[model samples]
Target: MTSLGVIFQPWSPPERLRETAVAAERAGLDELWVWEDCFKESGVTSLVVALTTTERLRVGVGILPMPLRNVAVLAMEAAMIQRLFAGRARFGVGHGVLDWMGQVGARVASPLTLMREYVPALRRLLSGEEVTAAGRYVNLDRVKLDWPPAVPVPVLAAAEGPKTTALVGEVADGLVLTGGWSADMVRDSVTRARAARSAAGVEGAFEVAVFLMTDFGEGAAERMEAEFDRWEFTGERRYAALGSVEEVTATVREVFDAGATSVLLQSRTDSDDIEGFVANAGRVRELLLR
Candidate 1:
């Protein structure tokens, strides 16, 4: 069976983080993801806290921007988190949106190139292998992790476009796809990714995760429509209209049929809209589980 995860957007204070983590576990979510945004708390800290508070939920930082920190340091952090959490941690790495990278004065010339070099380097470091590489963007000499992770850590690459998706298939263990993908797009991307992976003779199955909006209430359809309008108008548009329980179910089915192994529902709501978001998650969970 395909898995279902939740993206925890911490648009609130830190104190609420623990409560939200606990609530998600109670809601029967398989995994919980947090984002690292410039205006919000760091994803790593939130992930640590969430992992400590929850017993069985797998926690992931949806993405840690490549340019934000050194690759060696990232490997160390990943190792420590994996060890501390007793192997209930996953890492999602990506180039991040250009606007956010600009805030840190980091320029990503070619994301695919950076990922190709960085990911393998991080893996080597995590395995306690001496890494020495000279790439166009990143260069390192004799870097190794003294404390390697117990198991091979799953690294998920966030891909949106066709090129990136294909690259991810070639390199990454799985994919954390963007939110706006349609069923047709999802199908095509997955097929391409799988073919690339297969051609390369990669052993394990690839994961495809799609983000979707969820809302449940009397005026759920209106609420969803308004949300769609905002996303489209603001140029953050990557969403399928999942207005009702049936619609959400259909969307999930479409994605699954399109080759997604996991679907993560991202609850987009106001700061004070927790009740509705939770209700919507419950409804979607019912549909997905069914």
Candidate 2:
């Protein structure tokens, strides 16, 4: 069965996360994702709040900025979360927004190279293996986690372009596609990623997780239109869902049918009713289960 999740956009203040997470679990949603966007709340911190507040509510950090954090630091943090929460945590990493990276002096000239080196090493470290690499970006010296997750934790990477997507397939356990992609685009991306994995002779269960842009309640249609325009989204499909819970649920199903392993609903950042939005998402999850 395809999993359904919701993104707790960083745009909302930190105070709202606990209620939002509790609402998701109370509403029966499968997962709640948090963003580690630059100049925003820390994704790991948010995850702790959400996870500690509710049982059975899996939390995912959609994509941590690879340039800013040392791989060993991430390994330690992720390992602790896994040990504490067991199988309820998910992690993803990527080249953060270039402009933001530049602001913090963490930007690298070659993001693909950084990912190529960082992901595999991070995965190994999580699996309790010592990693020694002398790559262009990642330079590790026989570093291993003192306390690794008891079970393996799959590392996911975010990708928008073909090169990054293919790299994700070659090195990572899962791919996280951002919002504003149509179902057809997701299908094509999955095919491309699978081909890359095959060419690399990598074998295992690879997952494609998508963030489907969504809006609910009053003026949802207008909000969605504005969001699409901001995203410069073009095409007959619009790549976002609005209107009723049933409508958004249908869009989620369409993306799942397009080969997505999971669909995370990305709502507007300035949404007024965080709890209501989560409950609506729970309703959508229930509808999908039926």
Candidate 3:
């Protein structure tokens, strides 16, 4: 079955996370995800709070920016969390937003090279292997995690194009697609990722998790339209699902039918009903089952 989930946008203050977790857990939603927006809430810290407060909600820190982290240190942090809450967490890493990366002086000359070097070494470290490698971006000297998660934790990569999607197949266990794509776009991405996975001769399935722009209630349209204005989004409403719960439900299905192993509802950055939005995400999952 596809994993249905929601995003806790980092646009709000750090204090809002507890209520966010409470709402999703209480509503019986499947997963809760957060992004490590540069200069915003720390992704790992937010996951700790969310995972600790909820008994069963699986949380994903999708696409932690590689430029901002040391591969070994990132592995250690992920191991620590997964050990503390085994089977209840998901982690993803990728090239961060370039503008944000540059602001912090973490931007690299080549993002593809950085990800390629980081992923393999990270996998070894998390698997409790002694690894030593000196690459253009990542360098580790015979490092191994003293405390790795009991089982191998899956690593996901955020991808928008074919080359990066192939990178997901080559190393990562899953592929994450960001919001602002229509269902047709989702289908094409999944196809590209799978083809890459097959060509890589990799065993095991690769997950395609897409975040869909979704919102509901009275102000949904206005709030989302304003978001479009901020992003200078024009063309079509094909990518977003802004309306009542029933309307959003069908939109979720459109992406799912397009071949997402996971579909996460992303509330507009300025959305005021984040709690209510997540609470109703369960209805989308229900519709998918029927």
Candidate 4:
């Protein structure tokens, strides 16, 4: 069975997350995701709040920018969260928006190189192994998490191109695809990643978590179209699921059919009714289960 989730966009105030998480759990959604956006919310803090307030809702940080935090610090933070919540926490790391990274003086010339160094070190730390590495971007000296999670934590990484996608398959436990692109494109990415995994002789379940742009209710179409225009999206294939519960559900189903282990519903960032959107996603999940 696929895991269904909703993103509590960083655009929403931090104070609203507690109620939002409660709503997601109460409505029976499987996971709730948060992401770090530059000059915005802290993904780790948001994940903690959401996890603390709910008994069963799994919280994911779809990405923490690798440029902003040291590999050792991230390993410590992730280990603490995993030990506290056990299997309820999911983490993904990425290049972050380069412009945002530059604004904060954390930009790297080659993000691909950063991933090459960062992910392997992080996985070893999370697995309670001592690591020492000196690389272009990440440098550590026998660093290890003293309190790593007793159970293994799956570390996911975000990717857009073939090189990064293949790198993720070779080193990371899962792949996180950002919003946009059709279901067919999503399938291709997963296939490419898995092929890389096989070539690397990596074995285990490799997860694919996709973010699907979604909108529902009264101005769903207009909201979706407006967001698409802002992104300068040009495509005949629907980029977002829009309209009623049933309609939105069918559109999301296409992504599942294409091979996503997890699908995170990402509503428009400027949306006014986040809680309502979570509830609607719950209804969609019910239909999906049948």
Candidate 5:
């Protein structure tokens, strides 16, 4: 069965995080993804809160930027969350978008190199293995986690382009396909990433989690169009904005058929209408699951 999840954009007040998590759980979402995009509160912090509040749903940070923090800090944080959530925490890390990173005066150049070196070091540290490496971007000496996670922490690499996707397949456990991508776009990306994995004989399931937008109401078409317009203005990819419940179902099925082990919908709403979002998601879920 293809697992379906939802992305929680913590753009509202802190109180909204708990409320959204409760609502999403009731709505039958398998996972909840929180993101950090140069925002006020970090995604990991919000994820910790959500994990504390929720009972069964898996909580993940859609991505924490590699350039913004040290690898040691990341490893420590991941371990803490895994232990705190009783092993229900998953961490996704990536070289964030240039525009957003620039806001903090951070440069995210040569992401492939950064991720390639950063991931292994973080993994070794998290697993309590001695880390001794002198690489171009990262250099560590005899560092290991004092307290390792009891359960395996699945680290997903957020990749969009071919180079990054292949790198992710070669290293990380899964791939976090950037939201706003079309089904065809996801298919192409998965094909490339899988080929890389196959060549290396890495046999395991690679997650293809996508972020999407949904709206359910009589004026769904208009709402979807407005959502597309918002993406257009922000220069976000407009492929995930489907016009109707049927369109949303089709798009999701297309990705699933293309080898997405799971799909994560990042519902975008124009109003403070939680009921409307849940209703629209329910309709789309009914059509897709049926």
Candidate 6:
């Protein structure tokens, strides 16, 4: 069964997250995702609040940049949340926006190399194993989490490029597709991920989680069009849902049939009614359930 989710975009004020999270759960949203974009909210901090506040809503922090964090600290934080909330936590990591990384002096010459090494090490630590590795970017010495999750948490890696997608399939437990990819692009990405996993002899259910740029109600068309212009989105992969619940639900199903395990509806960052936007997520979920 494909699941539905909504994002509390980084551009929104962090103070706004709590109310919106409560509203989302109340509104019947399956999962709530938050960003760890540089100079914005701390993914771990915000997600902890979210998990503690909501009894059943699973909280996801999509793509915390490893460059800005120590793997040991990340492992500890993830373990804490998983232990506290059990099945209500999902965390992901990737190369954050490159320019933001550069601004903080955390930029690495090879992000792929960093993630290739970082993810496995983080996983090992979370599985209660001490990790010590010297790679092109990540290095740790005898680091291990004292209280790793009883079962290691499934970690998703953000990917849009083919190589990153393949690397994620080879290493991480899931893939987080960037928004603006068409259903066909989503299918092709799933295939590429599986191919890499199969070639590497890895086996298991690897999930494909994609973000769908969503627009609805008043001002939706102009919002969608402006987004396209801003993202410089062109070609067939500029995927978005721009109309009523029926249209958005159909788009979700199309992506699901094309091979997405979950679809997260992302409203524009400038959207003022964040809670209202999430409240409407229930509409999409309802149509999907039917």
Q: Which candidate is the best by lDDT?
A: 4
Candidate 5 ranges beyond 4 A from true positions: 233-237, 241-247, 286-290
Instruction: Pick out the ten consecutive residues of candidate 4 with the lowest summed lDDT.
Output: 229-238
In terms of TM-score, how similar is model 3 to the real structure? 0.95
Ranking of predictions according to lDDT? 4, 2, 6, 3, 5, 1
- Per-residue lDDT over 1-290 for candidate 4, one digit per residue giving the tens place of the 0 to 100 score: 79998999888888899999999999999999998998889999999999999999999997899999999999899989888887899999999999999998999999999999999999999999999998999888889777988789899999988999999999999999988868988988888999999999999988889999999887888778878887677784358888999999998899989888899999897886878899999999999989
Quantify all predictions' global Cα lDDT against the true fold: 0.77, 0.89, 0.85, 0.90, 0.77, 0.87
Tens digits of per-residue lDDT, candidate 2, 1-290, equal 68998889988989988988988898998999999988889988988888999899889997899999999999999999999998799999999999999999999999999999999999999999989999998889999888889888999999989999998999999999998889899998898889999999999989888998999876788888877787677784467877799888888889999999889998876676778888889899889988
Model 3 agreement with the true structure over 1-290: per-residue lDDT tens digits = 78888998889788889899888888778899988988888999999999998999999997699999999888999898888897688988889999999999999999999988888888888888999998998877889888988878888889877898888878888888887878888788788878877887878877788888887877777777777776676765336887877888888888889998888898877766777787779777776678
When superposed on Cα atoms, how far off is each prediction in RMSD?
A: 2.4, 1.3, 1.6, 1.3, 2.5, 1.3
TM-score of each: 0.90, 0.97, 0.95, 0.97, 0.90, 0.96
Model 4: lDDT to the true structure: 0.90
Residues 119-167 of candidate 6: C-alpha lDDT, one tens digit per residue: 9998888889988999888789888777889876988999989999999
Candidate closer to the true structure by lDDT (higher is better), 3 or 5? 3
C-alpha-based local distance difference test score of model 6: 0.87
Pairs with backbone N, CA or C atoms under 3 Å apart (clashes), candidate 4: none
lDDT of 3 at 256: 81
For residue 123, model 2's alpha carbon misses the true position, in angstroms, by 0.5
Counting clashing residue pairs in each candidate, in order, gives 2, 0, 0, 0, 1, 0
Candidate 4 residue runs with Cα over 4 Å from true position: 236-238
lDDT of 5: 0.77
Off by over 4 Å in 1: 233-238
lDDT string, candidate 5, 1-290, tens digits: 77776767756667788887787777776777888878666977888888888899888887889888788888888988888788877788999877777888766567789999998788777877888889777887877788888877877889978999998888888888866777777788888988998998888767777766655446765666677787663443666645566776787788788778777776664556664565556566677777
